[model samples]
Target: MERWVGKVAIVTGASSGIGESIAEKLVKAGVLVVGLARRVENIEANAKKLATCKGKLYAMKCDMTKEEDIINVFQWTTKNVSLVHILVNNAGGNPGTTLIDGDASRWRQCFETNIIGLLTATREAIKIMRDNNIEGQIVNISSVLAHSNWYFPTINAFDDGFV
Candidate 1:
């Protein structure tokens, strides 16, 4: 973490859970952290509590499912701060849909957010890293559901197509 001082790290879904925790840790370590989520206010609240930290936390509204929002996030970040040095593909959701009985839209939504959205953000982050020669790093946060064999029949949730 000390090595990341003054570097820029982007954490998606930073409004809560692991993303929020990571953001807090990074700021304390002196790394500029951008917390992206639809609920930016939550991140803002957390940032206010971290005023004494070595680094800073910036809250940006971004819906990972939309390409426009993802693009806007990177564009705005690069234009304002320096190029991104780290990317955390931590924004992910599931529809709790079963393979035998489920809505197509729910599956589609999961696919868009968890798979396509992560890919898009990673690509953009890589471009920034390459263009700036930042030697950037990417951390993808996934769940135990990522394993295909872990299935619960009572919950009717399928682990397929999860990342």
Candidate 2:
């Protein structure tokens, strides 16, 4: 619908799955898209698949858990593209693990990547938007597990913080 024409967007975990879909949709709508993920090759491959979009596409390797990476990505976008108009926090995943049976390290990893990472990215995005006085959209990609009892309490806590 061209709702994103002239806008810039950042989509995390955009190398595959839902993040990839969101990036495609944004590009189709004419948004300059910056895709961030740990897998640089995958993101670059995906960007190459979007040759039809009228907007520019940049794929960056960024681990959301790292504040420096997030900051650099935001800075790169601002320097190369228009002010970011949309931010899709689409990273995070939890393997099938019951609360009691899950490995402590695994659980910790999930919380760090899903909750802490999202917060860090959001903080940086907000800073950029506020500093530029840019009114933007933030589309947080959250799973139902955030509220459902099927997941750990940490998931709910993370979702609550975002709300």
Candidate 3:
């Protein structure tokens, strides 16, 4: 934590769940945090509770599935804050639908968010890190289903068969 003091970090899907938890942790650790999510208002509300931390939080509305949105977030963060020193790719979800019975769009949405979105964010973050010579850290939160093939009725689409 001491080492990350005064650094900058970006946490995607930060409106809730793991992304939100990571954002709060980073802020408390003295890292200026940029929280990106489609639900920017949620992150904005969270920022208030984290005011006592040493670092600052900026919530940006970004749809991870959109390349333009991801690009805009990186650009905005660099201009408003500083180069990224950490990136947590925590934006992802499955429709809880069966692969065979699933809507193609929903499957595509999952892929875009879990794979493409993470790559895009990582690429942008690396560019910033390279330009600024910051040896940044990246934490990708993967699904528990990544390692299993269980056939749960609810999370059928989340199994390794599709992961």
Candidate 4:
């Protein structure tokens, strides 16, 4: 991780939960982090708390379901923090709809966020890495419900999407 010190990282869904923890850890390791999520205020608050850390944290409002939002985030990072050395695709959620009885719109929303959004972010990140000749890392985060169905059954429950 010391090698990543002073590097730039983008973490999605960083307003809370696992994403928040990952962002904090990276910042502590001296990695500049751009935290993205719809709840930008939460990230801003967290950034304030982490101000004394070795690295800096920037909060951005991004809705993973929107391609433009994802693209804008990357652009912001490039112009503001430098080319990203790492990207964490940590934003995802289920629409609370079962397979048999589900709303198409809700399911589509889930797919866009969990699948399309991740791919778009990955593609953008890779392009930056390749263009800059940087060996960057992309981390996709998912829930355990992806592997086991014992938990609640949801139409958009994370599974194999990260793959």
Candidate 5:
């Protein structure tokens, strides 16, 4: 972590939960963190709380389900911040609907966010790393549900792919 001081990282779904925790820790290690999420205000609020930390946090509005939003965030980061040295793909969720009775539209939303979005972000981050010749890190956060026998039809179905 000390080696990452003054480096740059992008963390998706950083508005709350595990994403928020990751961002906080990275910032404390003196890494500049860009928190990307639809709840930009939440990230901004947390940024304020961490202003005195060794690093800094910037909030960006991003809807992972939208490819354009994902692309734009990376572009914005390169132009506004330094090239990214780390990427934490921590954004994912189910619609809380069971497979048998779930709406197709909701299911599509879940797949778009939990699967396609992650792929897109990882591809973009890799491009940046390759172009800059930086041996950066990419962390994909997956739930224990992926490996469990406990069935959460909506969640396990998607999360399982990560493992």
Candidate 6:
């Protein structure tokens, strides 16, 4: 079933893991898939494989933590594709540091990358989607740790807002 035929989708962190799986699913559904990630080589290599799939695949190098990079990805998509129909915000990871042993710098890094970066990307995506009159879906990949009551020091340090 080509449920996503003619649709455009951007999947961040598409270089590996769940992000990769999501991109593959979208591609199989006939969506034009742009895989964005910091690992340029990995995404590019994957894009080559996706080229033979049911949809078009474009791989772009993007550092989610940087505003310029995010903007560039959106601009590129707008320029080359008709519209963005979906955005998968899938570029976050646990730092594996407990609150008691983790330095303030590490804690800040997690918040910056997971929370701030996601917000920035979402804002830009919304702007583009709204301006183009494209009704799009934004899927944020959150961790189970965000809700679990287990007292992992690192997880506890994260703000509730991130959950």
Tell me how far candidate 4 lies from the true structure as C-alpha RMSD in angstroms.
1.8
Evaluate residue 97 in candidate 4 and report its C-alpha lDDT on the 0 to 100 scale: 77
Tens-digit lDDT track of model 1 for 121-142: 9999999988888887999998
TM-score of each: 0.92, 0.84, 0.91, 0.94, 0.94, 0.88
Query: Model 3, poorest ten-residue lDDT window?
Result: 154-163
lDDT of 3 at 122: 96
Query: Tens digits of per-residue lDDT for model 2 on 19-127?
Result: 9888888887888899999997987887788877776568999987687898899899889886888899999876335455556776666677787788888888888
The residue pairs that clash in candidate 6, if any, are 99-153
What is the C-alpha lDDT profile of model 4 across 1-163, one tens digit per residue? 9989999999999999999999999999999999999999999999999999999999999999899999999998999899999999999887777767878788788888889999999999999999999998999998775566554566444333323
lDDT of 3 at 59: 93
What's model 3's lDDT at 146?
A: 67
lDDT of 3 by residue, 1-163 (tens): 8989998899999999988999998898899999999999999999999988899889999988899999999999899898888999888887667656777777677778877888999999999989888888998887776676656764554432345
TM-score of 5: 0.94
Write one digit per residue (lDDT tens) for candidate 6, span 17-96. Answer: 88888988888778898888888788778778877878877889998778888888888998997568888988886666
Ranking 2 against 5 by TM-score, winner: 5
Provide the clashing-pair count of each candidate structure: 0, 0, 0, 0, 0, 1
Clashing pairs in 3: none
lDDT of each: 0.86, 0.79, 0.85, 0.90, 0.90, 0.79
Worst 10 residues of 5 by lDDT: 154-163
- List residue ranges in candidate 2 displaced over 4 A: 1-3, 147-163
- Which sections of candidate 3 miss by over 4 Å? 153-162
Count steric clashes of candidate 4: 0
Better of 1 and 6 by TM-score: 1
Tens-digit lDDT string for candidate 5 (1-163) = 9878998999999999999999999999999999999999999999999999999999999999999999999999999989999999999986777767777787788789988899999999999999999999999998777655675565535442433
